[model samples]
Structure formats: structure tokens, C-alpha cells
Target chain A: MIRRFGSSQVSALLVGLVAVAAFAATYGFDPVPDGLPGLGAVEFPRLVCLLLAGMAVLLFLQESPPHDPETAPPIGRDAWMIFAACLAAVPLMATIGMLGTIAVFLVVAGRLWGETRWPLLVGVSLGMTAVIWLVFVKIFRLTLPGGWLFGG
Target chain B: MEAFLGGLAILLDPYVMLMVLLGTVLGIFVGALPGISGSTTIALLLPMTISMGPVPAICFLGAIYCAANFGGSITAIMVNAPGDPSASATALEGFKMAEKGQAGLALGMSAISSAIGGIVSIVVLIFAAPLLARAAYSFGPPEYFALALFGLSMCAAIGGDSALKNLMAAALGLLIATVGMDLTTGVERYAFGVMELSDGIGFVPVLIGLFAVGEMLDQATRRFGKPAIIALDAARVPGMAEMRKCWRSIWIGSGIGTFIGALPALGATTAALIGYNETKRWSKHQHEFGHGSIEGVAGPEAANNAAVGGSMVPTLALGIPGSATTAIILAGLIVQGVRPGPHLFTEQPTLLYAVFASMLAANIFYLVMGLTMAKFFARISLIPPAFLWPSVFALSLIGAYGPNQSMGDVWVMLAAGVVGLLFRRAGFSPAPLIMGLVLGGMVEETLKQSLLIFGDDLTGFLHRPIAMTLIVVTLAGLSWPLVARLLRGVRGARA
Candidate 1:
């Protein structure tokens, strides 16, 4: 039988409900018009809640198993490292033009993906970055961030 | 006809032609790259194109949208990585063909089918839009609400998983859409005093975050999976024999895509999915599916391309975006001081014609580029995930921030990425949410207007033939699956 109370569904339901309730508590007023036909924003959320509640009930009754742990795909080690590094890069991207950010990301990615040949990897990565950079800057005239180092 | 010829003349000018070709080539390259989608490509380019003549810019963006929609299939087939979600189904069969050393044939089939679907859709759009616009001229709010309801119901009915879930997602989307100021009452509903929330979350940021960043997170989880080693050789174009095999699928899929695209709120992804499902349902060898069936590739690729064309219909005829990308494109049009409603055809016939011409030209360019670049683009599949994910993630941020140059948008991307990941884990498809957001305002505004006109009597919908027709069709659409399931159950019981 499917486990409806799996952590994922429970979390989603909780977050979604909390979000709705927070909105209601903060901005909501009582006496939302009753017997309102399905028209306008006033009626829309009421219907939405009915639908969500019904879905929650359906989830409870379904026979699907919680995600099968045995068949679960591995969250690769390299992916985690890359994700962490990329998150670090988001704030820095404004200082570095897209090309610069791409260059660093490519080099890091190549290493993490286990490309032994650095020369080929770096060459292709930089080549693509340069092409995109030149196109955006020269042809399209869109100004990508000029990294602090590049001095525009 | 004279207007069409005049429009054609304007599109054929050397400058317009050059831009179309350039846009098509650029679109193909960008689309072939993983992590970049047609919407981002257009968003990045639209700002630059704004200063140019609007006709040329429309033509340029048109080419990009058309070619990019087709270009995504290249990565899908070669690397088993879909460059865009629309091409995900294509990868199912296209990647299998590559595994079987038929990468060239697969590429060729996709190119031809994409070209055919694109051309057919443009033709239909060119002819059908004017007629539809004429019909829409008589439509008031009730008609529009009925139309939007029909569209939303179609998504709920046809979504592959539970109808309840799709409705929930769409309902949630509609609710989220209402979180800003109420247009009628001029009072805030859910903004909670956040000024940014007052604008109600700009569409571009939300889209980039949900679709693009969410996609990256999903891809990141697969980082450790074994990469497929495609034996890269000169990719061959599919021979005429194979083309003939999938021609029927291409036609049916294109028709399906165009029809779905013509529907408000439905996008290329929906069309592609529906086409793929329908192809599998109708095929004699459904068992061969999920294992590199050529029909699988042809059907989805065709549908998506056609859907691109289909989406333009509402934008031009009714000022509504049929899909997210088109919605962005519509915003771009408005930024350029062009109105994209039915008035556009009468007011800006040359621009409309130019768009049509660019769409037609994009197909030709897509065919040419796909044939020549198949071998070269296939090499991208071999690029490792470490480098790929970071670069893609970075690009997603840049693309997300490009439209308005807002930092808030970047945060939106991050939040959307997290939310998207949560939704994915919870087995919720983001497609319905997208449909809901795109159509939500229209549903609200239209329903409000309809109620003002009809005064709480929904039976007023039956007074209008077109509205009544849509309502009937929506009911049929919702019930078809249930009826089919019931018949299947009866047969199983007898067995």
C-alpha cells in the first residue's frame, strides 16, 4: 500500500497550508461572501482550498508506496560540491561578467566531472565563453557584468 | 492577400532576412546547450532587439522561439539530456536511437518533423488567427472566462497523473496569482505589506526560478549517475524510408500540438506530452516505446514546434499568452510599444506578416543547421556534470536577472528553486502550476466581468453558443479518460 504520510507529502502539505494560513491570518477577513457563484478572486481561493483538501484526502487513500528507498538514485558527491560552489558564486556573479563566471564554473565542473585533460577542457570552456561574451557585448550590445577585475 | 504579400515583402527585405537567419542559428546553438531554454534566449535578446524596428525584432524573436523549440531535441537525442523540458519526451526515444547507433537517423527525423510541424503551424496560424480574431471580436468577458475555463479543464483532464493533483496545482496557482492587489476592489489581498509582493511577483523571475533553476536542481541530483557514452561518429540524416515510417505521427502530432497550442493556457510542453501519449496509445508497437521508438521522437518534436506556432495565435488574436514563453514574448512586445491583441493584425499587418515569415524561415534554417551541426552538438553530451551544472546554474541566475536587472528576482529564483525541488520530490508536476499562473489573472478578471454582466447566473454561459460549445467540449474532455478507464476495467473483469 502507498504511504500517504511520507515525509515529502507531509512537508509539502504543511508548508502549503501554513503559507495559505499565514496569508489568511495576515490579510484575511471573515465573512468571505457565502453562496458566491464561481466568479472573481473571492470565490477562487475557496474552490482552491476545497480542491487541495480533496487531494489531501485522495493522497491518504491511495495505494502507492512512499518512494522506494532501495531504488533511490544516489545524490552524487560531485553534484553536491558543485551545487555548493555555484551557490557561493551567485552573489559574486554581479561582479564577474557572465563570461567570467562561466569560465570559473566550467573549469570547476570539468575537474569535478573528472575530465583528465585540462587543456582541452579549459580551451573549449574559454572559447565558448569568449564567443558568447563577444556576441553579447559587441554584436548585441548587451552589457554583461564587467567583473571588478576586468575594469569594463 | 495583398496585405499578406506586403507583409511577405517586408519580411524578405535583406535586413529582416539576415536577422531571421542569425536568430535561427543563434537559437539553435543556445537551445542545443543544456540549461538554456527558448524563454531565456528570447529574454536575453529582446532587450537588445528593442531599439531595432519592431517588425525586425518580432521576426528575430519569432525565429529564436521557432528554431530553439526544435534545437532542444538535438541534446535530448544525443545526450539523453533534454536542453528544455519540452524535449524531454524526445530524449526518451532519441537517446535510445543514439544508443543503437542510429543517432544520425534520429537527428534527421527530428529535423524533418520539426520543420514540417513548424511550417504547418505557421500556415495554420497565418490563416486561422484572422478568422479567430474576427470571432473574438464578438466575445465579451463571459466568453473569455468560458474559454479560460475550457483551457484549464483541459490541463486538469489531460495531465498524465491524477486529475485531482493537476486541479490542485492549478487551483494553487490561481490562488497565488490572487495574492497581490485586487483589481476590482483596489485592496491588497495577500501582499502582507511587502512592496515587491504588491507587484505580485513578476512573471519572468517566477518562471526562470521555477522552470530553469528548478530544472538545475533536478539535474544536480543526478550528478552521480553513469553518463551514457555515445559513440560519436558523423551523425547521418535519416533516409526517406524512415521518414515515411513516422510521417503519419508527425501529421497527427502537429495537428494535436496546434490545437492544444490554440487553447489558452496550454503550452508546447503540454502539446508535446499529449502528442507523445497519443502516439503511444495509437501505435501498433506500444511495447517498443520507452526504448527508442522513432514515432516517440517524431510525435513530441512535431507537437512542440507546432505548439510554438499555436501559442502565437492567442497572443496575436486576443492578447493572451498561451504559454509561459509566449507570455514573456508578449511582455516584450508591449515593452516595444506594440499591442499584441487582435488590433495588431489590423494595425500592424506588416509586423504580423514579418513574424509569420520568420517562423517559416526558422524551420528551413533549423533543418539546415540540425543536419550540419548534429555531429558537433552531439559532443556537448559528453561534457561532465560538475562543470555543466555550475555553468548552467550561473547562466540561470544571469538569465533570471537580465530582464529587469533586479536583485529581488535572483532571490525569487533561489526560493523558486527550493520550492520546485520540494514539489518535484512530492510528485507534483510544475506544468499545471505554470498553466494556472499564466491563466489565473485572465480567469479572475474575466470571471469578475462575467458576473457583473450576468449577475450570479452561470446558466448565462449557455446563452452564448460559443461559450456553451466550450463548456460541452470541456465536459467531454474531462470525462473521456474516466470513460476509457471504466471500459478498460470492464474488459479486465471479463477476462
Candidate 2:
């Protein structure tokens, strides 16, 4: 017979499965040398994995309720958009530089988040970039990467 | 006396004081804004503080922490939006008081009681931390291991939606902590061919991602409609007569907040909640509750602010952070190469004293600011999330990179942000995971040392009295819930 699982059960099952996988991966770790009087790298992690697995199984059986904060709303399309933009910025930082990346991210994010005016987006984008340049680069003297396109 | 005087001197210095002022201003600003909390702000600013000396850096962060608790009450009172989670208790009656056109009175009570509570807790911190540190001199590896375990055991109880999920998050953190080369075996475990991972995950990046960028993503999920503004008089400070009415509750809240906050893994939010409850339990005007209750505002506001100082005790003395904000502060301490513990009091007494002084000063600053400029600070809540959050995202990316100047760290930050998003959706607290990450290395190191010293005999832990005592305490704490349940079942059967 097949059993249907709820979110909490799914969560617990996933955690237990990952812990078991990690327990399996411990074997790939090198063993402690004979003369060394200390633990192998996997000893502590291995112990933790077992504990986690045990706890997950218990949780699965218990079928606890989700502890969502009172204020938090469900993740919407906008969150995914922001997450994607954030991920895209990391690679873009190498190609387009810090300022360029910041500007691109702000404009794209602002527009996508439903801002109508181009001038306002451009203002916020450039304004933020300049403020950061002054604070981090000029006044604080922090190093920001110039990217492969422009040398710092 | 010399250390105390030296600390006061640091507070008196123009540069340090300026930074403290800046931190206080920024703290109130962000603390009065919903969706941007003090913890997130501290994480965002951590990298920028790398150039500053540790003393100023700590003072800046400390000032923000102290002021923010009070600042959170501003939004809670004005709009029923608690800018900081700690002020949720305040929002209940405070918003009612606002509806009753007693916003000024409630705001006044919150400020005065918050100042008194904050000062009381700082006084406790000043005396309590050094005494707590002295006890640490007797602790050995096994003792520390037990202490770490005791801390981890509490993770199931603190700040989370579910106990099991909190434990899972912490386990995940411990896994993350094990990514670098092992200090004992000189063997790499899970670097996965990444050079940055060889040194282990950088605390700064992880913290930035978890608190700042993660919060930004959470903010992105939905739009905030503006709450109706409650008009309040900034000049209407709580009068002497009003103070007399709330005197008992202010003290009760302060005492409870300090005591709860000193406990491992507890913080201001819990303190304020209990404070609110106890204040109701003991209040003469119980009828005033759930309406426009000035005592309600006073109790929780004081409790949360008091907790700010109380939480510092463990973070500074035991290196076990009592709250998420203190966790960030502890990370800052570590980032500045200042290892916190018993030795710190002896080695850096002046610095410790300065931190205490700055916290004291911050309490006073926010009280004055909260009372006078609250009307203005309340307006900050009106700032559009569209403008505010995008700026935060930009800064988060830069802040993540500023630490190691490596794109890899930025990549890690982004990944952690996703993890943070998942964590929120899954109903987990990031605090336990942070606690696990912070204590993971020490737990392994101490356990290894204990084993080496004991010749791999697990029973050797039985010989260390302090360690044994801590282990027993941990066992009891973890079992108490089950014991209570069993007792209840037996009683029901008998009845």
C-alpha cells in the first residue's frame, strides 16, 4: 500500500534521507592514522548524521505542525524574481563589474517589481550605485572588482 | 576601577562617540522600519566595519542593538507593525492605545520604561559578565563540550516554529561547519575542490546571506500595504503619576527579561512575551489590558530593551550568543580576531568595559531620541518597500563580496539566501542553525581533545564533575517534556 505524506512528513523524510546520504559519504573520508591519537574527520559528522536521522524519523512519526511566522506571506512570483536576480548578479559581477552589476540589478528588479517610471528606476539605480561607491570605495576604501572588462 | 575608567574614556572619545551616535541613528531608523531588523542591519554592515578597530566596531554594533529594541516599539505603537520581532508584545496594547488617541502616552511609557529596563539590565551585565567569566577559568575541554551540547539541546525550544525542524536546521549547520580541512587529522572532508571551502565557510558571508539577503528575499515575496498612521505627540513624556501606576510592572518586566535573557539560546523576544504575561498576571488594572493599557506598553518595551543588555552576558562571557543579534555581534568579535571567553575579561578588560559603557550610553540615547524624535522616526515606516529593499539587495551583494573579495563567497551568499528562503517557507528559525555553525568547530575540537586526554574511554566524561553536571542538566532539559507528558497521562488515568 502507498501512503500519502503531508508537508511536515515530506520535510522529515527529506531530512532523514539527506542525513543518511551524508552518513554514506563519511566512508569516502580518510581514516585517522595509526599513531594519531585523535578522531577521524568523519567521527563528529558521523555522530551528528545519526542523531539527525533519528530525530527526522521521530518527527515523521509525530507529524508536527508548521511553525510559520504570523507576518510571513506565501512565497510569490516576486520572491522568485528577486532570487533569480541575486543569483545572476554573482556571475555578472565578474563580467560587468560591481557598479555595473548593482545598476543592472536595481533597474531590472525595480522594473520587474512593478515600478512604472524609467527615470525613477534609473534614479534609484544610479543613486544607489553612487552612494555605495562613495561609502565603500571612496570613503571606506573597500576594494570592488572592476571585472575582466575594466581594470581597477 | 582602572578598566571601568578606561572604558568610560573610550566612550568619551569623539571618534568612538561619533560611531556610537551613527549606529544609534541607523539602528532607530531601521528598527522603525518593518522588514529590516537590527540583526539584518548588523550583518549587512559587518564587512564595512572590517577597517575599523575592534573597539569602535563593537561599540557601533552594540549601540545599534541597544537602540533598536526601543526603536521597534515606535512602529509597533504607531502602526501595529513591529519593526523588530522583540516588539510584537508591545504592538498588542500599543496599537489599541493608539486607537484610543493615547499614542503619546503609550509611546512615552514605552520610552521611559525601556530606558529604566535597559539601564537595569546593563547594570546586571556590568557585574554579571565578569563573574560569569571567572567561572569559566575552571572549565576544561569536556566541560566545554557539555556546555556546547547544553546549548545545542536548547535549540529545539528557541525562536522556531517547530522543534524537529529547528534540530534539522542545526544539523544542517553542523554539516556546513564541517566543510573545511580537519584541524586534527589534517585531512580535507568536503571542500569539493573549492579553495574557499578549505578554510571553512566564512561566518560573514553566511550571516549576511542568512539575515540580510534572506530577509530581502522574504520581503520580495509580498507587497506591504501602508498601515494607518497614528498621530502621537512627541513631547508628551510619561509623567510622574503615570510612572507610579506602572512602577511594579516595569520592575517585574525588567527582572524577568534579564533572567530569561541570561539563559542560553533565549533572547529579547521571549523575554518581552513573558514580561507582558507576568505584568498582566500581577497588574492591578487588569481591565486596562487588551485596551489602551499604558502598563502593557511599559512592561514589554522595558523587557525587550533590558534583554538587549542581558543577552550580551553569554555572548561576551561564555561565547554562546543568547540571541540572533548577539550572534552577529559575536561573529563581529571573532572577525576582529577577538576570541571571547574568560580570557577576554583579563586580556581586554578595557574593551569589555567600553562595550558596557557604550551600551549604557546607547540606552540613554535612544530613550532621549525615542521620546523626542519618535514622531519623526514613526514616519520612516511610510518609506516604500520598493525603494528600500532594492537598495538593501544591492548592498547585500557588495557586503557579501567585501569580506573575501572572492566571487565564490558571493556565490555562497546567494545559495545561503535560497537556503534562508527555504527555511522561512519550511517554518524554521535561522538562529539555531547559526548557533550550530558557531559552536560546531569548538564542539568537535573539544570532544577530540577530551578523547585524546581520556585515551578514547567514553566513561572518562564521568570523572569530570563539572562536565558530568552539565551533561546531567542537558539530559534533564531534553527529557522534561516527555516526563511532563507522562505525568499528565498518569494523572488523567488516576482521575
iRMSD, all candidates? 4.7, 1.9
Residue B191, candidate 2: C-alpha displacement in angstroms: 0.6
Clashing pairs in 1: A2-A63, A2-A64, A2-A65, A109-B386, A109-B387, B104-B236
Q: Count the backbone clashes (under 3 Å) in each candidate.
A: 6, 0
Q: Per-residue alpha-carbon lDDT of model 2 for B1-495, expressed as tens digits?
A: 799899999999998898898889888998988877778888888887888899999999999998888888889989999998999999999999999888888888988999999999999999999999999888889988998888777787777667668778878888888888899888887776778888999888888888777777877887666677887667368889899999999999999888888877778898999999999999999999998788998899889988888889988898888777888889899989998888999999999999999988888888888878989999999977777787888888888889778888888888888778767766778878888888888889999999988999989999999999999998998888889999999999999
DockQ, per-model, please? 0.32, 0.63
- The top-ranked prediction according to TM-score is 2
Over 4 Å off, model 1:
A1-4, A15-19, A22-57, A64-152, B13-15, B34-54, B80-102, B157-161, B224-250, B264-304, B319-339, B456-459, B479-495
Residues B1-495 of candidate 1: C-alpha lDDT, one tens digit per residue = 877788789877998998899889878877876766787567556555644678887888889999887778888988777777689889889999888888888888899888898899999999998888888888888787878777678557434346756666666677677767766655566666777777776665666666666666766665555456576566567768777778788998899999988876677877898999998888877888988899999999999999989989987888767776786677567657787766777787877877887789889988987888777766665566655555556556656666566666777777877666656655565656766776788888887778767787877887889888988988888788779999999999999
Q: Which candidate achieves the best lDDT against the true structure?
A: 2
lDDT of 1: 0.74
A1-152 in candidate 1: lDDT tens per residue?
22536644564465457446744543363333455443434465565555666566665455544564332345678767756766666666667755677787778766766666888778868886886667656776656666576654
Regions more than 4 Å wrong, model 2? A1-3, A64-75, B233-235
lDDT of each: 0.74, 0.86
Best by DockQ: 2
Candidate 2 chain B lowest-lDDT run of ten: B226-235
